[model samples]
Target: MKMKISCKPIAAAAALLLGGCMVGPDYHRPQVNVPATYSELPGWTQAQPADADAPKGAWWTGFNDPLLNELEPQVAVSNQTVAQDYANYQEALAEVKVARSALFPTIGVTGSGTRQRASAGSTSSSFTRSVGSGAQIVNSGSLEGNVSWDLDLWGSVRRTIEENSATAQASEATLANATLSEQIALATAVIDLRTSDANIDLLQATVKAYEHFLEVVSNQDKYGTVAPSDVVTARTQLENARASLIALGIARAQNAHAIAVLVGKNPEELNIPHSAAMPTLPTVPVGVPSTILQRRPDIATAERQMAAENATIGIAVAAYYPTVSLSALDGFTQSPLGGLLHVANYVWSLGGSATETIFDGGERSGEVAAAKANYQAAVANYRGTVLTAFEDVENDLSGLRILAEQADALDTAVRDATHGTEIAFNEYQAGTVDYTTVATAQATQLADQQTALSVQQSRLLDAASLIGDLGGGWSDSQLHDPRNPDKPPAQPAAASAASAPAAQTSSATGQGAQPAVQ
Candidate 1:
């Protein structure tokens, strides 16, 4: 008796094979120690849950400088460093799509035609032998379509997609970080430029005062009331003040060039006018130290790196399982190139294959071990990044606090010095003190004023630094993940601005001349 094989059991087996089990552990975020409050300040509040999803503002706007407000926005558009990072981010998103494509079957179509001359002796069929001793011309053609699928039975492809997705998110964070840095740099350069202007103004006033003193001594010498040495001393002091005033121009020019470059312009293309105006030092609120995890882009980059490395462990673990491939071909072929698509000439096939490595000299085990080690290193790096972020905020806070006290003390000294300079000049005019005493008092007053100006500059610079260290309004929740479209979006609509569509279009093939800033 002939036995029949049931198609039902074979189909069921195929279905079970296609739906294979995953072998690796799922990912979970690693825990790290977080401080409840910032040590530098008191009454620190934790970041509210709602704040995580809140839209970030342009932090530079708080400085209240109209020129700065105008220049800061250009950094996102024209700065080459930020543009390069944005391009890298677009490339990362494309990688995620590449990894994702592996989850689906690859379908292709092919067509071919060939003409050949066959000798009679080479013929294996009677029909060809009947053609004669001469070579016979033969034509063949095929129209075929194929489907291939590397089944993700162990979820290796999915894990790879996960890794790429995390990496893409990390790239987004890196772009944000770069943008914030450039903005802060621009602000710093502006501060230095304004400080230079203030110094020039102070030196100009000192030169005028010195010139007046030289005139007074010269008049007294003509009247035979002051010694000739007094006139020489006054002239020397005036010349030195003029020399210092000329030197101040060098720093002012250099700072102006730096500001121009930060805004993505040539030095000659921009000319900031000297203004008595300066950026106001902004008051930044210090939240709990743990907020750094959600606030800082560098911290987010580290965290995402950890997640990517964790996904890599799953991919490496999957290497131990067998790889299964399913293939199908449907085609039409004819030897004479006639009626190729006819029912009689049509052909089809379905096949499945599985490959397993029984021995690899422990290569697979080594790969798995390496992947785990990388993940551990990433975890360590993440924790280290968190600690460094806290350190940065603390340092800024302490510097600002201490610098404020110093500024107040310098103000008092400046006031007292100005009064002493007037008294010394009055004593010199009354012939009670020598020109040396008046010169000494004037130098002290100038020094005190310059020191006070420097303190103000430091305070402004520290304020910008503190804002940048706090992520300049960026939050970890703003990461735009191309792989997880259904997840709640962390990127605000305003944050997307001009970058959203550009990023979307670049993912199709990852080719773009310039990537937009977020």
Candidate 2:
């Protein structure tokens, strides 16, 4: 004959798995008022089909600098700040695992031995229930395995996992943000260093020309064809040119130091070679403004934080409901040592328990309120970040637009000034123009060239900054979504790209990581 199985435990398990309802408001993406089109968008920046999608790694390659292509990858691997952020992301991932563990039962094994001489009339209720007091000396031993589980009848465990999973993803985004920032910073520093080299070359050329002019004036003085004071003025201009060349050393050194620290190297250990070639600025694709919500890592981080805090609301709400637990013990016990081995000595217990907080005056309510407030703060921060992203794009676009115009105008001015310098020098030799007038013209020519160099540097730096503000090629799906409590979300296309340097793809298709979600 077959024995009937108990239905009580089976029913309890089924109810725990099926009957619990999730409490609290499901997260909603805050209604941010994104602009239809960036008001400050410059006409020069049009959507290029080539840049329509941003690729993941090696954005610096767009500049086509072999050195930048080599150094940009180092930022992800060696930068100290990126290291810290990466460690934090690992910690957050561990926390997600910890929270997820709560959804399952815990099992423990226990063994105990006791030897005692009890008084004939002992009156301890707990000890009396488990042991007898008939004899003066007695020994007892037992071995047991216990299993306990808190039924998630109010979605508490699921909610905790939801919160922590999102937090882990937010931490991942933060790591990506750090990596992107330092890489771009290094790129800009490299640009500045190169520009300094070019300016130094320009100054050396100016000094040589000034020395020749001084020689011409000194010969005129010796021949008594010009005032002796003309020699003094010419000598002074040559000296000033040399001094300006020397002053540039300070800026070049500082920029070198910044690059060293950024790449996790000592200043003395790394020395960039001097070069006069200016880096070409790439046309970074300005996708539609709405893409800001999905492209940037910091924004993704902020948005994930909002979802994490939103899940806490339900966790706090779970506290208001009674907690249900199931516990079971299976063991062997006997009063005497030899009897403990007998099959009949086996004992077992199966039970359920419930706990409810009868009075805490408004603690649960206060906790719920605090969770809501924190979520609101995250929402505000997220919206603010979105607005700032738009501002960054607009600023970059305007920089490119206005700077393009300014550069064109400076080019014309430099050409005109060069012609003026030639004319002024010819007139000076002919005695038709004052030496001082020629000196002033030479100064204007040098100033215009230096200004043009600086403007080019500014444009390069601003172009990189605009790319950083555009989110350094990160996606929101890279982080876990809390709303899918029971489902496995598909991994993001570039999920592995963040941690794998070898996975770096060419910027051929905007970089190679993948186009971010629209």
lDDT of 1 at 454: 91
Clash pairs of candidate 2?
A: 55-510, 56-513, 296-471, 507-511
Best by lDDT: 1
Candidate 2: list runs displaced more than 4 Å. 1-19, 41-49, 52-56, 114-139, 480-518
With candidate 1 superimposed using the best TM-score fit, by how many Å does residue 197's alpha carbon deviate from the native? 0.8
Backbone clashes for every candidate come to: 0, 4
Evaluate residue 510 in candidate 2 and report its C-alpha lDDT on the 0 to 100 scale. 47
Specify the highest-TM-score model's number: 1
Per-model CA lDDT versus the true structure: 0.79, 0.77
lDDT of 1 by residue, 1-518 (tens): 11123347545754674466666777788888987666655422222222333224676766778878899999999999999999999999999989988877777788898877787555443233244657776677888888777888898988898899999999999999999999999999988998998899899999999999999899999999998999999999999999999999999999999988888899999988997876776545454566667778999899899999989988999999998898877878877676677888878788999999999999989999999999999999998998888888878777776676687699999999999999999999999999899989988999999999998999888878877887877778778777776687665444322211110112223433211111
lDDT of 2 by residue, 100-199 (tens): 6676677677878887776655433333334354635556777777777888888888888778888988888899899989988898898998898889
> Against the true structure, what is each candidate's TM-score?
0.87, 0.85
